[model samples]
Target: MPITGTTRVFLIAGDPVAQVRAPEIYNHLFERHGIDAVLVPVKVPPARLADFVRNAFGAENVGGMWVTIPHKAAMMALMDRCDPVAQLAGAVNAVRRADDGAIEGALFDGIGFVKGLDHFGIPLEGRRVLVIGAGGGGQAVAAALALRGVGELAIYNRSTDRAADLCARLAAASGGVTKVAASPDPAGYDLIVNCTSQGLKQDDPLPFDPKRVDAGAAVEDIIMTREPTPLLKACAELGISAHAGFEMLVQQIPEYLRFFGMPELARTLQDDTSEVRALLYPK
Candidate 1:
């Protein structure tokens, strides 16, 4: 429902809010749909997220929020209830404020990435997927894929313990089909998903040797800013199909809109891709 007075406000909150593209993309969508809504970025320190959300809830215009980075796990504690994916992933990346002022949280990154893969016409069912980095993002992606009935999932992290824990969790959830293991062998896998922060900075070594990557496999990097991270560039040179983080960003918005009780607006806005691309990949 639209707000009674003025505009409905949405926010994406994280430590480093200046770099976020959500406001641009979402505001454009709001404009296109003729909704009295505006999306903004909010910079909240890790310790202040709970307070911020509490205060924001009192404001009648505030509708929803997007949480990112270090806060995805922390934000779950502030919500009234979490969606199934958020509960399983142990994190929340989006939150919606209901008419009663209750907050509902959900994790969209994993599902969004799979939606991106689908957008590119890539199939995950029965395909062997190699996921590097067993961090929050990796765990979310692995769980999402397993839920989609992927044939095999091999997860690797620098810390073997983390990988083992994540693997065990996924295996239990997947009914023993998802396999978690160490090593960057890209061979025999249909998809390679990078969920680490390694590519966010320059001069970072390739997480794994590019030569070992299967030439026929598709590569997906969750880092959004740099279009061609070293790993993606390597995959490209080797004739591999690759997807960047923008695809995930684009795929996530619709789910977020629905969580905020605006499914029609979400569907209407998603029909246009040019505006989203322009916001995400501004020159």
Candidate 2:
């Protein structure tokens, strides 16, 4: 919708905000749905995050904000209330103000990832899954898969301690359903997800051997790139199905809208959003 003085604002805040495409995708949705809201990217450095949260989010017309990159975990400390999912994941990627004026938070990264896989006809129920990287995104995916009833989960990180910590946290939260990967080998798992930044650079090493990825297993890279990440390309060459990271971002749109109290946009968004999706794969 055209921004008026009364237009509600939603912010996607990160230090390096130029690379974020959330404003494009969400602003398109808002305009198409005729909602009087706008989503904008804000470059808020880590040190100033707490003050920004206190001042900006308290605005009467501010709907909510999406947190990204180094801010996801930090936002958790800033929220007055949190959804159970965010609590278990140890992070919050989005937040909205409550009726009582409290900032309520939710973690949607894993939810989006699972929905993206479902869109591709990949089911997690009873599947053995391996997630590489135990950072915020990795932890969120692991927690979501466990709650979705995946039969087994293996978490692997360069830091064994971080992976092990995520395992223990998930196991405790999910009643003993998660474990640290014995090895990074991915031979037999039904699903392997790369949640790390391994594929961002051309010379970046593969997180794991593509040969070890079974042809029967599906591989997903969580790095949003214009071209196929190295891991995805390797998986395709090996006859393993692969998916891009933005699949998760796209699939999470409805959830984010709902959290922002704009369920109307979720339903009214144009079915053909190819142009918007293309912008996500920036050159």
Candidate 3:
């Protein structure tokens, strides 16, 4: 896909943008569909994130922006409208500027995540779950699990305050679902999710010991590394059903395209994803 004077542009912003898979998949969608657009990656530090949203994101060529990591939480304040999902998740991973100049923020992490869990036969309804990280991805997944009518929800974070706050928020919106902020204990959980970037680096420590997770439980990590992450590999060693991080990201592509004004594009990716997955997670 070549750049042109009239090319419409979108961006995926994060502090460490090099590992992002969004630009690849999104650009492929744009090229194959003949859309005069490009989804580019930009390393926007925390200090400059606000300025980018206020000025750069409002440019004529800028059609949308995808938020990641540290920026996902900070983006809410910059959006003109925050969707219900984002409001509940306390974060937004996708944002699109409406024709009226309103930037509507939305969350797709949980939608994609839970969809993968369902496809893999790991049902969320009435099941107890534990989430690690309590960051943008963690919050979104936790809120999604709560809305799915999970039996219980527990959150763990390095920062106890963050974990406690997220637990409170999820509890308030979780209805009857029991929510707790506790250390990573996989004793009674049906599913344990690692929403942090720990698996991105080989030296990174496991978010929690896979052996601590009950033999009957399932595990998932939301980090796509060069290979299976240590945590997922450990889960595999323990004979647990471990899900790939790509599942969450790929499933969310449709939601993102719709938010970007290409609603019909969702159908193109509705069923077939083998090719896209290969392109994204290249072995």
Candidate 4:
């Protein structure tokens, strides 16, 4: 897959794009699969997101865009239509223009998070879960969890109102089947997921006390840094099973491929993502 005039270009936009790992992961997949596609990262400030998106989509060769960080929530308004999950989560991480020039949007963070849990054999059905964050990522993860038949879902955010709002939305979407509420308490939960940026900094304190997590409970931090976050370290010390965000990210590759109209490639990758996982997190 040499870069050529016919290459399908995909842009991933964020204010600080240097930290993004999508280009490396997706480019490797495209090249290895003999697909004429390229994913590029672009630094677009929040104020210029709309303009940047409009101008980028004007180019005929542009296939789609990947939204990150501050852009996910804002990207929702830019879509002609959004997937139900995106609407429920109030965010969109992937966007593409249809043959009719309609902009379609979707959020894969939550879906990927749940799938990653499955990949690690962490059961979710009928399990009590606590999500510590209510931002875009948190909302997406919580929304997905509620729909996954979790026995109970609790959200904890610095802003109680935000967490409460997300819980309400999730409860309504689940037809009252999911017992969701806003609470920072992690005790008694079967699984705890950290969806906050607290773990991004080395010195940042653990999102929640691992000692408070129940015995045999598992924890997952959605922070994708190579170094283990403090939360992971604390869980390890407590003899609790903990995981990094690598699997969650690795799991999203196929979803993005399918959203971008590469269904065949998506299916192929879904059947076996070990190669991608190894590339991202080598043992």
Name model 2 segments beyond 4 Å from true: 269-283
TM-score list, all predictions:
0.90, 0.92, 0.88, 0.92
lDDT of 1 by residue, 1-283 (tens): 2444788888888998877767777777677777788888889998888899878878877888888777898998889998767876778998887667678899998888888898999998888888999888898888788678788888888888888887787786665766666587677788888888888876788877767766577888888765578878877778878878788877787888888778887776478656666766777
Model 3 per-residue lDDT tens digits across residues 1-283 = 6889999999999989998878878888888878888988999999999898878754878988898877988898888888766888878888877778777899898888988787688987778888988877888888788788888888888888887787777776677564555677678788989988898987889888888887688998988665899898888888988987778877888778877888767777766767567776777
lDDT of 4 at 51: 84
Question: RMSDs, each prediction?
Answer: 2.6, 2.1, 2.4, 1.9
Of 1 and 4, the candidate ahead on lDDT is 4
Kindly list the per-residue Cα lDDT of model 4 for residues 129-223, writing each as its tens digit.
Answer: 88988887798998888778887788888888888788788887665644444455678889999999998999998788788888888899999
Model 1 alpha-carbon miss at residue 61, Å:
3.1
Please report, as a residue range, the 10-residue window in candidate 1 with the lowest summed lDDT.
173-182
Overall lDDT per candidate, in order of appearance? 0.81, 0.84, 0.82, 0.87
Worst 10 residues of 4 by lDDT: 175-184
Off by over 4 Å in 1: 1-4, 99-101
Top-down lDDT ranking: 4, 2, 3, 1
